[model samples]
Target: MPRFFCCLPLAVGVWLFSLLFFAWGTVLTVVGWYGVSSYERTDLALTRRQLVSLIITTSSWTLLPLITLFGMGAALARSPRALKAYSTALWFQFGFSVGAGAYFIYNLFRRNDGNFVTNCTSRDIADRDTCQQAFNVLRGVIVAVYVVIWLIEIWGGVIVTQYATERFQRSGGGVQFSNAPPPQGPGPVILDPVMMPPPEPPILGPAPPGRFAPNASGRFTPPGGQPQPSFVPTAGGVSLPPIIPIGQSAPQGQYAFAMPQNAHGPGAANQV
Candidate 1:
C-alpha cells in the first residue's frame, strides 16, 4: 500500500541476492582451503601451520558475506544522518575487503612459487589457490553490492532533501518561502492613468468692452458709462437708497413736485 514497501523491497532484493552469492563463495573458500591444507598432492598431507591459516582465511571470507548483507541493507536507511553514516561505513568495509582479498590472493600464489603447474599439482597449493579465488570472487561481489547500495543512497538523499524543503516552505521557513504570501488586503484604488478633467465651456455674452466691471469702491459701472455710486448711510446709521441729499433737490427736472412752506427751514416761499 505504501510506496516505501514497493521501493524498499527492490533495494533489499538487490542486496540480499548479492549476499547469497557471496555466501556461496564463502562455502567454496572453506572447502578449497581445507582440501589444500590437509591433503598433499600425492597423499593429502597438511602441516599444522597450513591448517591454521586455512581456518583463519576461511573464517575471514565468511565475514565478507555477512558485511554484504548488513551493510547493503543500511544503505536504504530512512534517516538522512543514518544513510550518510551507512554509506561511509560501506566504503570503509569495501576498502578493507579489497585489501584483505588482494593479500590473501598474494599469499596463495606466492606460497606456490608462481608455478600454476605446481599450484594445481601440489595438494596444498591447489587448495590454497582455490581458496584465494573464492576470496577474490567475493571481493568483486561485495564491490558490486556497494555500487547498488550507493545508488539507493543517492536516491534516498534526494527524496529527503525534497521532503525537507517542502516542509520548510509550508512552515514559512525556507529560502523561497519567507514572505511568500502577504496578508490578504483590499486592493489599491486604480485611477484612470490617461484621464483628465473636462474643459470649462466658453461663456457666450457681450464682448469685454461692453461688460460691467466692479470699481475700487465696490460699485458696478454699467457698460453704457453711467456713474453708479454706492448707497450712503442716513442719520440713523442705516443704509439709505442712493438719492439726492435733503437740502439738495433732485436734478432740475428729474423730480416734479411742489416745495413745502418749510422748504427753506421756517418761512421759505412755496414753489412748484
Candidate 2:
C-alpha cells in the first residue's frame, strides 16, 4: 500500500535471497543425510563428531521450506507483519550461521590434533597428515560459504526492512524519495537602464536674488525706500537638490560645473 517506487523490487530481492538460502540449505541437508547413510553402511561405526554434524545438517532442511514460504509470501503480498515474522525467522538462521562458522573455524584449527575427525589410527588410513589436510580444506570451504551467506543475509534483511517501511512502496516513478526540496525563492534584483529616470542637471550656485528697486523721483527719498529688480534669467536653480551624474563625483562644498563666475580673494565682489 506504500507509494515508494523501490518497494516492490526490493521485496522481490529479499524473496529471491530467501529462495536461494532455502535451496542451499536443502541441498546441504540432503548431502548430510547421504553421508550419514554412507557411514552407517561402513563396518566402522560413525564417530561422535560425524554423528553430531549429521544431526544438525540433516535436520536443517526440515524448517527451511516453511521459513522460505513465509518470506516469499510476505514479499508477494507486501505485508509488513508477515515480513517481520520472516525477519525473525532469518534471525534464527543468522544465529545458526554464526555457530556453524565458529565450529568450522575451530575444527580447522584442531585438524592437526591426534583426535582429528578422520580416524587415521585405523590400519587402512596410511597418510594421517594427508587426511588432516583434506579435512582442514573442507572446513575452510564451508567457512567461505558461510561468509558468503552472511553477506547475502545482511543485504536481504536491509532490503526487507526498507521495503516494509514507508519509504519504499509499489507506485512507480523515477527514484521516488520522500521530502521534496524546499521551494526556491525569487532571484536577486538588478537595476534596468530603461526603467530608470534620466538624471537631472546639477546645481552650480545660489540663485540670483530678485529685488524691488525704488521708483525714480527728483524729491529726496527716505532711507526706507522701496526697491524693485527687473526679472532676469538665473545661472542656477538652487531650490532643488543637485543630482550627481553617472560615473562622476563632486566635492561636498562644490558643484560639478565646466566654468565658474564667482570672484576670488580680494576681488570676490568685482565683476571684472
lDDT of each: 0.46, 0.55
* lDDT value, candidate 2, whole model: 0.55
Give per-residue CA lDDT, model 1, range 177-235, as digits (tens). 36567888876555442353222222244324323445667554554455444455434
Instruction: Tell me the deviation in Å of residue 157 in model 1.
Output: 16
Where model 1 places Cα greater than 4 Å from the true spot, the runs are 1-18, 25-29, 32-59, 69-86, 111-272
Where is the poorest 10-residue window by lDDT in model 1? 198-207
> In candidate 2, what are the lDDT values of residues 62-169, reduced to their tens digit?
456668778888877766677767777876776775665565455445435434434544645657677667566765786787678678767766666666553223
Q: Which candidate is the best by lDDT?
A: 2
Q: After aligning candidate 1 to the native by TM-score, how far in Å is the CA of 203 from where it should be?
A: 44
Q: What's the CA error at residue 25 for candidate 1, in Å? A: 5.1
Q: After superposition, how far is residue 141 of candidate 2 from its true place, in Å?
A: 1.7
Q: Residue pairs in steric clash, candidate 1?
A: 39-44, 39-45, 40-44, 40-45, 41-123
- In model 1, the number of clashes is 5
Clash-forming residue pairs, model 2: 4-169, 211-229, 212-227, 212-228, 213-227, 213-228, 214-227
